[model samples]
Target: MTQAFDIIIVGAGMVGAALATGLGQQGIRVGLIDKAVPADFDAHASPDIRVSALSAGSERYLQSLGAWPALVAMRATPYRRLAVWDETPHPLSRLLPGSLTEVEFNAAQLGADHLGHIVENSVTQNALWQTAQAQPDVTLMTGQGLTSLEQSPDCARVTLEDGTELSAQLIVGADGAMSQVRTLAGIGVTRDQYQQQAMVISVRYLGPPEDITWQGFFPSGPRAFLPLHGAGDQHPDETWGSLVWYDSPARLAELKALSDAQLMAEIGKSFPDRLPHLTHIDAKASFPIARQHAKHYFLNRVVLAGDAAHTINPLAGQGVNLGFQDAQCLQGLLKEARRSGDDLANPRWLGQYEQQRRPANRRMMLAMDLFYHLFSNQIPPVHLARNLGLGAARALPFARNRVARYAMGLDEQLPGPVQQILHRLPGLNRI
Candidate 1:
């Protein structure tokens, strides 16, 4: 039997599930397919090692999809302050004050209640899954993997591993960076792997949950801190936090081999002094970082969103936020398409989506890559230049706030100066 839908979205992760929910709310028949279901939330379990910093704009989008309340009910930590500073030591560093070397954004100063929320990836996925499932127009095909994809002049179709066939006016590839749907749809990506790999550690600290998150940049890479929820009665007076240590593969491998106690000691010595006293190591994992962008956002009846479209450095915690932006953009376009009584795969709307999103995604990728390259370089001139840049940002409040607002998705355009910098960056035409 053939299952028909207005659209079939592959990969029911954050972006796909949210899209399904949004489209369903508009009365669009959607098939949300994924091989694995999000794990049920458990209050007593340790925090998921994989987490994302959801920006305020992303919060509003999720709230519109009816997932934010469920996420808060499960667990979400809002950070009112975000700080980034240069930690690399140099003989010239003694000349500058600590305040000049660091730039912090406060919610109060920005006229916002909180900057963003640090959420476990599982909790977010589960919340979106629940919201998606509640949509009467959405059919969630979980535990079924996509095996094949086919497209005709009229529509696109996909086959599951169990031989169940589904057809829709459009097939969306939201499966992620290594997207099978992307491959099946014949889209290619340009990928550049970074020298440093990020190792994330989930641990409990001896303090209440924190309202701030910070990252210290080094020659190797940036080490970051994201505060999670508090520990339960089993460990009274403790809170959970996530730490990211980015370094060479060999160095992270050595740290990964250490016992819990040994790793904790090493973390104390290596991470910024501001890290709270960690009480227990719950889980740890590491993966290589890369900048990837799809050559095209759509091909014929198949379209891409989220990680399927692009992936950027995780330094700023903007990956999932970008994905959410993609979902929101595509959802709006699809709604417009339905209103016009056009095929959901109409290139007119899909082209507009790519046109609006590509530059935005590319700009973010370049910005992150700029930070990655600038901070990772050890050349004295580069180091001094970056420090001066940070100092200038702190010294100039208006420009600093403008950049911050752009990053927070509160502003649509990157400031003129920043846009010019991105434009002049080498190899700008390629990415």
Candidate 2:
């Protein structure tokens, strides 16, 4: 038997699950399909290597979907300050004789308690999954991979490997970069792979949990530190943090192959002196850096969201945050369509989503690309220019606060529907 739903979402990652739960809460029938459900989160488990810096906007939206509190109860670390510095020496710096180039942003300057939260991807996904499972309008089909997808003017149809068939007025491609739904829809993506690989290590440190995150740029790339919450209240002494080292693939491999002691020593030698001392390496992994943008967000009755729509460089840690913004924008549009009794798959409505998000995402991608090329260059002139810019930015408190607010995803004027949703959410009217 072919089950019918108002919408079928492919992939149950954080973004997909958020969209599903939002729609289901509105009384729209939602079919959420994923290859596998996230395993239960253990309070005592080591921190996951994959993490995202979620902005205030994302926090509000998740709270609206009833997932934020669960995530906080699981594990969430708030970062109140951000520091970026370039340690490279230039002829100008030697002549002028000043402190090393560094810029800092403080949440207190903006009257906010935190600029953002660094959260494990799995924890957020599991929280959203719980919300989805509790909604009567949501039907989750787990362990079922997509085998075929067919879309027509009236509806989109999908077949799963487990022999289950489903149809919906619209099909959402919330899958990651290698999205099957996007492929089947004949949408192509423009991709650029950075030669650098990010080596991520989770470590147990001796210091108390910190509220600041920092990054230092070298000729190779940037080394970043992200603070994480402890396992639970019972283990207050067990503090954790993540280290991101960006470099050529070969260098990453060499680093990854080091013994735990050797790797810890290497980190101490290479990273800035301000980085905390690590007592233990809990986990380690590496992934290539790449930027990908879909040629189109939607075609016919099919559409894309999250990584399926675009993937950005992780240098600024905005990858998943962008995905959440995509979900927020698309959910607003779809909600309006459902309320008006219009075809949810209407090309005009889908085009609006594409038009609204594509350019914004492209701008961010290009900004990161600019940063990658500019800061990665070691020429004396380039170094001097960047340092000067950083020094100037450090002196401009108003501009720094503006940029910090933008990074927190508060600069954008929320759309009408999204604003209404936020207003209805208790304690989020100001967000």
Backbone clash total for model 1 is: 0
Q: Write one digit per residue (lDDT tens) for candidate 2, span 302-348.
A: 89999998888798787888898889899899988887789999877
lDDT of 2 at 157: 94
Across 87-150, the per-residue lDDT of candidate 1 in tens digits comes to 8776656775555456688889879899889999999999999999999999998898888899
Candidate 2, residue 216: CA error in Å? 0.6
Query: Any idea what lDDT model 1 has?
Result: 0.85
Give the clash count for model 2.
Answer: 0
For every model shown, what is its TM-score relative to the native structure?
A: 0.94, 0.89
